[model samples]
Target: MVSFKKLTIRDILFRSRMAYYNRPSLAFVGQEPVTYADMAVIVRNVSGMLNTLGIGKGDKVALIGENSPNWGMAYLAITSMGAVVVPILPDFSGHEMESIINHSEAKVVFVSAKLYGQLDRKNIPGVIAYILINNLQPFDESVTTPTAGMPYETPKAIVNVDYCDCELPRPDEDDLAAIIYTSGTTGRPKGVMLTHKNLVSNVLSTLMIQEVNENDRLLSILPLSHTYECTIGFLIPMATGASVYYLDKPPTPAVLIPAMQAVKPTMLLSVPLVIEKIYKNKIKPELTSSSLKRKLYSFTPTRKLLHRIAAKKLHKTFGGELHFFGIGGAKLSFEAERFLNEGRFPYSIGYGMTETSPLLTGSSPKLVRFRTAGFSIPGQELKLLNPNPHTGEGEIIVRGANVMVGYYKDPELTQTMFIDGWLRTGDLGYIDSDGYVEIRGRSKNMILTASGENIYPEEIEDVINKHEFVLESLVYELRGKLVARVHLNKEALEKYYENLKHSAKDWQHNAEEHTRKVLDEIMNYVNAKVSKFSRLNHIVEQQEPFVKTPTQKIKRFLYKE
Candidate 1:
């Protein structure tokens, strides 16, 4: 739907300037929004500042910050000025951030106030300047003062610039726009090089899945540094002149609930963990709180009715204006998808990686099914390599305008990332006769049985996650046998032993026995659903949350026993 002379970030920005100059662009919830016209001015000032600091086209400028209006401004200023933007995840450790910054060879760094203390000046000595992203002010250590182990000083830190008449370059479609470093579950971080065509084409392709306009509102809870949120959640909406709201803090219930009510967003982007938590922690418990309710929820018609009621309340809790809810970055639990479809909730699923501009296949709410990842987007061609004759599963390879150039500065690995010119997706899945995609699991995480059967641990873990007391479960191979690690719901565990808690003085041993009993029940339930080779031999308590990426996918490298 987007008409442009060339597929470039500059085209997206200036088109919005001409077509919707007065429209709202970005804002935090309950705050004044920056208009498109205002964005053009701010972007120019920021670009002018970068030029003043001796950074220009082809140079990399790093942005380390939480989501805010200024964060978007910094991104546009860097990319539209023909410089590459290197966005660092705010959740990364100080060491990780330093390594990424130095690796990218950034000329200037824009850091948020909250993360300034974490910036170690000893290692990343390549940075020429540091500007505060909150107020666009250039500062040095001589201007800062430390107090009580905290860096605090009025020190004229906030600089408000009004305008800049500096000239900016028009980038070609092949020009590099961003160098995004992904801390994946595989091994180490890799810098992904995305061109203007790769991103602009992806933003437009994703719009075919779900359209937005100047009137639509989006609440962004995901990190802007991740390609999934940056391309679809931020860039696509901005290209269509939609309003996007950010949360000043983390998206805990206390912050997100109020912000949703205030914005009443028409569209939202999220990973499965957000909805899974609401379903398991909130709706699932209420529907099965009593024997009669559990019986009713088991029946077909009654369960549908109950689901509809719960879905309605859930919709209202999101301010009752949601029309499209996109879940991506990881595979959603099957139990949650069934609830959404049966309940008539407006939910969709997508599949992609940071290497593919983050969107290869996705579905609108109308086309979504129980487990399908839906159809490939426009301008993308998909094929299976060495598919199983029985299951039709294989490595999902793709050729598309949206695929990244390659891993930045890693030609050796990038050469291995493709097979006969088709980019290897590293995902194992099948394309059905109806052209729908179903992703099984990652290839690296696949387990091989002694008899040579392919075992996808995700399938068994899906069943484990449905248990009432299970919050999340991980499946791995331990010495040729499948073992599961489950994080229990403390509230659910307490409620299960309410009688023993009040009546028995010696409750610790009783609690352990009860937990062991539930684990056995869950193991039996999962083994019955899976193939014999895929059955879990043991289910152990994890006791802590799994380490994860910014997108909420578990970091499997740590638990690959």
Candidate 2:
């Protein structure tokens, strides 16, 4: 890891220019690259704009938008000028968005025009202004023009409103950097207050774990509003003088592939679902066209060749030097991880909840470990509380600088989260002798059988995830019987059945046969690998896919009876 013994966020940004001197720091779709020189100017412009608006030290501002260069600019502008930034997820529903705005008490809101309508001003307090990003609609006197430059001028009536050059306050490291709302799996969202020290320290610690340099170019697709991207993608890259690119539109294969190949990014931070979908839907069918290709893929010798081809193909997609491909936000299937590993692809598995500034553990290229999530990140503390001796598993507890200050303004709920100052991470997992952390499902998500056996649905789902035709699986007990609700891969199924000698009566018959075969294979494999208590009894197939979060994690509670 790079040493930042005396570095601050300001120092990190400025020092990188000295190191990488002439590199681009940011590139937006269809826009000119913002060089290190331009970065300084933009930051100052942001400071000037805030000063003009009477926003200063200790003020709270909310930035709500899709992942874009402007999003990063707004965040840095606010935090650098001694104000707290509240990053609202762009996909948040109208009610959730309103609740966060009211709770954060932000005096200014920077929102995308598409989502601006979702915010109701009734609950927001003293919001001096609303700045539209890329929208040209007329607003109140407080609506300001974008600092980078706007073709349209401020109306004469609002022209004299103050946009000043007041000095930016120099806040202490302990000052709040952001208040991020975590997508609660079982309850309403909580605003996790992360201080400047919390975010900067986490970025430094991550740099220590993974050695990224000034030349490293990163493709930023994860929501900047999320801690995962803010910490790893934005802050870390800026700290090291790496240029970050934001897509013009949503991240589909068509949009991402061109951006990736053009940028030839050195790094990519993403969820497992992205790669898993590509593998199951695109890669699997190509490899199983004939019995020989299928047999060859199953064999280690031939699998190595397949892996090389896959790595090369992926390399082409990412523009090479694709040294670090990180997967997080949810558990990945064994098959997907194995393919990447066997193909000699470099990737990392990270594990953390939003509360820890999200970097509790991760694996690097040199220290790759597939099954386990990896050792704790530098500087954080971890422990398991109330372990089950036999299984060596229990609730995961963490305490460190990276942990959020507290849930925003909800002292009662916040008090319950910290048991003797250690954050009660709802996850259940254990550490290995080598210090690696392997996470099981959530402690609250565990289902106990009538026979006095405790079973984890996520563990069974992980096993089922390995099947070729399965996209996602959710396991839960219904009427004393363990059942699995699964989503089949329609495209993969159609291709597989098309190759069959006998024509099926209908698509339903073909799907039933495929489902039965998959269930029998997965059941036999899991039953052999797991204890009888953990084995699933029956499987249910759905033509429709389960609704998922941005990270592709199935909202289990949404499908519950």
Candidate 3:
């Protein structure tokens, strides 16, 4: 019921900060949290400091960091003061970071201490200064900054602007708030331009599906740079007076389990891979550890019971208070979805991209279907273009208030993104009679078979990933034959060898033979589940896991044969 169409990012900040003035806003685990009152003053100080550095409205300010309270504060400070923020993912390689910096022509960079070394501003011009985010100190005195010393500590020229100050070219609902360069599967990093309204629209529409309030505690595991996290995980929490906790390190099990207990997060937003890994690597193995249990797990009624038992333990392991477990960025594996549905875990799958303000079609935990991405959000239109007659699948085109304005400065690329009036998602899906959206796969990832069958490799990959020994798998075409490169779990492979009697000369030979047999079994198992055209001809073992984008999506461009 909260209307935010006319509100800018700055307006949202002032409203929420004043309303929840003394409430905790952001914190690191086991550390003193920053209250809304504290964040307001900090954001104000940081904005005043940026202004002192000659940074003004429409100036590009870049931010790169691991997920932390400072990162969240910096984002607010940059956008609230009318400067466009360019958020670079922490996982971006040195070359990738340099490319983004050079392309964006950022006047100022606010980088965290951990990822500071990646910024090579050797010959890049127009860069005014690099400010360290943690302490807000001058990162580089060599740059042509307005002042040499700390402006955050003591600014030479400070313009104290009130929330209702009248000024020309000030932060507006239509003004460009952030330009996020997407590290997509296409290998082209294009800047996605989102306005204050674009982001706030998503935050408000998301609230329609789920409620976040002052009493809510959120454990943020995804990168703050990602729109999925930036809008839903960060902005949504800020708007509704919820508290968010971030981890200084990566979200490994050892680090997360303890943090979950400490924070007792009421809601968590994640990509499918994170929860899928938890289900695959931990819960499933523990439940079917014995032969008798495996037999019981094969039956539908008994499998549901086993999944329910494991899901209860899993819920407690995540601090026992998680209500809305929102998964997005990629499709949830059907096997994993069945587990969550049967186990009665409060999980919801969201489907969208950075260009759509990261949420176009999604459901709340209670409204979710087993494998559907639910209906379009409020104020959005979703329709299929050129849908197949039989399957009813086509490119999922959308037009919505939450959609990005366009790709930054690249008019050609921006023009190409939209067709007629709707933005071309390039995702293949269909709307069911009941209005549930089922995404088949990306249109680019679909393989056109010699027999003229449209095969989605992702669907096959999902089946392949369900195998116990298979950690992950990538399905691709090789010389007109479907082949999969599988990354096996070393421990699971070894366990297979331990449980079986193999005719091999030595331990090494036995392990190798057992691995080959296991991969073959996986291939056969996956083939049995898929249609004939989708069957994999060969299964090759990969020594290492496939390199992924920040959100754990496999960089398909890197593996193209």
Predicted model with the maximum TM-score = 1
TM-score of 3: 0.94
Candidate 2, residue 451: CA error in Å?
A: 3.5
Q: By descending lDDT, how would the candidates be arranged? A: 1, 3, 2
Clashing residue pairs in candidate 3 (N, C-alpha, C atoms within 3 angstroms): none
TM-scores for all candidates: the values are 0.96, 0.90, 0.94
**lDDT string, candidate 1, 394-487, tens digits:** 9999998898899888999999999888999989999988788999999988988889899888888888999888999899989877899998
* C-alpha positional error of residue 491 in candidate 1 after TM-score superposition, expressed in Å: 1.0
lDDT of 3 by residue, 1-561 (tens): 555536588877888777899899988888878888778777777777787777889888999877878788888888998999999998898788877887888888887666766666785567887888666655554553332232222121233453224332459888999999987888888999999888998888878878888999999999899999999999998998899998866888899999999999899988888888888888888879999998999999999998898888889999999998999888888878999999999989988899988898888888998889988888788899999999899999999888889988799999998998899999999899988899999898899998889999988998998888888889888899999999988877666656776323555756666678778899889889999889999999988888887778898889877
Give the whole-model CA lDDT for all candidates, comma-separated: 0.87, 0.77, 0.84
For candidate 2, the 10 contiguous residues with the lowest summed lDDT are: 152-161
Clashes of 2: 2
* Candidate 2 lDDT over residue span 302-372, tens digit each: 88789779877887778877889988888878778888887778888998877888889997976978777
Q: Which numbered prediction scores highest in lDDT against the true structure?
A: 1
Question: What ranges in model 3 sit over 4 Å off?
Answer: 141-169, 501-505, 510-513
lDDT over C-alpha atoms for residue 255 of model 2: 91
Q: What is the C-alpha RMSD of each candidate to the true structure, in Å?
A: 2.7, 4.1, 3.7
Candidate 1 wrong stretches, greater than 4 Å: 145-165, 499-505, 509-511
For candidate 2, the lDDT comes to 0.77
Error of 2 at 546 (Å): 2.2
Clashes per candidate, residues 3 or more apart or on different chains: 0, 2, 0
